[model samples]
Target: MNGLSRLPRLYVDPTLVPTAQKGAPCLLTPEQARYLGTVLRKKVGEQVRVFHAGMGEWLASIAEIRKDRGGLVLERPLRAPQPCPPLPLAFALLKRDATDLVLRMGTELGVSEFLPLVTERTNTHRINPERLHAIAVEAAEQCERLDIPTIAQVQTLPALLGNWPHQTSLFAAIERLDKRENTLHLPTRQVQEGDGLLIGPEGGLSDNECQTLLKRPFVVPVSLGSLVLRADTAVVAGLALLGNGLRSAPVSSQ
Candidate 1:
């Protein structure tokens, strides 16, 4: 018996498997089936594991591969469904290229959800959820993450803070005197089992936005570093600190 190891590295969409259910047989969509069965040369009885969004994980075996959908004869459950711990990014929108970069990096850095905001200085809040989801899927596939991150609908900074109920909120800031002196730190696993991080636009959050966050109960102002960074740069840099298994932090806290 070959123990189930992940082989659902979906390099293409059509080959992506449907979210496998626990202890219940499921079929891979046409595109995914063709890729696995035809393109990748996988066949009946092959063992593979597939993941759904925080539905724990699924164990399945290839039962049939056809021109359309592929069938999987699911076996006994391998692991209990694990929900993603709270992780959110309230980020301001930027230019097309910059936003895309932030979205991609943020996904790999393990942001459970994204809230795109249009601040005073932001260019647009034109978020492409589908494209972002695709980016996240690719990132998750490459990183061997058990699930794909969710891209929340775009919302304003004030709006997001208004309805805030859960999560430890973090404001990415390296500007205040004390903060510049080095009070900035990233989220620890234990500290962030249920927390969220905020990244401003390229121009940074406006004074009003900053003040609003400061007043919020859950928000904690944080700093990235000495130099001001571009929107995309801050996103990648900030998320790198907030999420784990990425490059090391630029500096240690005092």
Candidate 2:
């Protein structure tokens, strides 16, 4: 995985590639192969982009093919793609349709990871990891992205904020600082470049959750708009805004 930055290209793997890297043979998983062969219709010697987490993105070329299994030749390196903009989205689970929509959008939006928070008022925290991974993989392939974002098991709201990572925390509270201007440049106002966000459940956050957030120095509460946003809408809207924040900031120094 440490070599990820040097290998952001497409690959064909017979066995699962635990980590993709320069000069490494990234075997496509059966699911990945099915998509490349049946859905994508890619053949041998076809060029593709592949990546491993934290290694950033890279490009690869197919060398051979055997049904839906094959080998890949790591080609010249692509310009170092930035480590996925340090944006993490934590939101409560929505109903079935809405939850699936959020999963799809979160991948496309480049969310680093998802923590499905179970709040006291959460209607259901039901989620299938396999199905969610399918959604994320399909979204990445369709979006022409090099990497697959991670999805963690659903966690309780209290447990999520209790031991916050030592970084900036942006709670996309439905009733906090309003407007895009508030979200813009918030990273500068808070901790550092790494920004994590949390959106409320459909019914919105309970008084205890909001108060718990307010007391944290790392947590800077912000709003998406004046009108109430559905759980899915808030996730997309917040990601779009936060993504823009990462794009506008000056490139980080290593």
Count of backbone clashes, every candidate in sequence: 7, 15
- Scanning candidate 2 in windows of ten residues, the lowest lDDT window is 5-14
lDDT scores in order: 0.66, 0.69
- lDDT tens per residue, model 1, 1-254: 24445455443232344444445666677877887878878889886666565344566678888877787765655556564556778788888777777767876677788888878888886877888777777777666556666787888777887877645555445345254322334232323544677788777777777766665657767667778787778777767666662233244469
Candidate 2 residue-wise lDDT, 143-214, digit = tens? 656567678888997687776685566655656454323344444343235687788888888877776766
Whole-structure CA lDDT of model 1: 0.66
lDDT of 2 at 52: 46
In model 1, which regions exceed 4 Å deviation?
Answer: 1-6, 9-23, 53-55, 76-78, 174-192, 243-254
TM-score of 2: 0.75
* Candidate 2 ranges beyond 4 A from true positions: 1-25, 40-42, 54-68, 79-81, 176-191, 250-254
Q: Which candidate number would show the highest lDDT if scored against the true structure?
A: 2
Candidate 1: clashing pairs of residues: 14-31, 14-32, 15-32, 56-81, 56-82, 173-222, 173-223
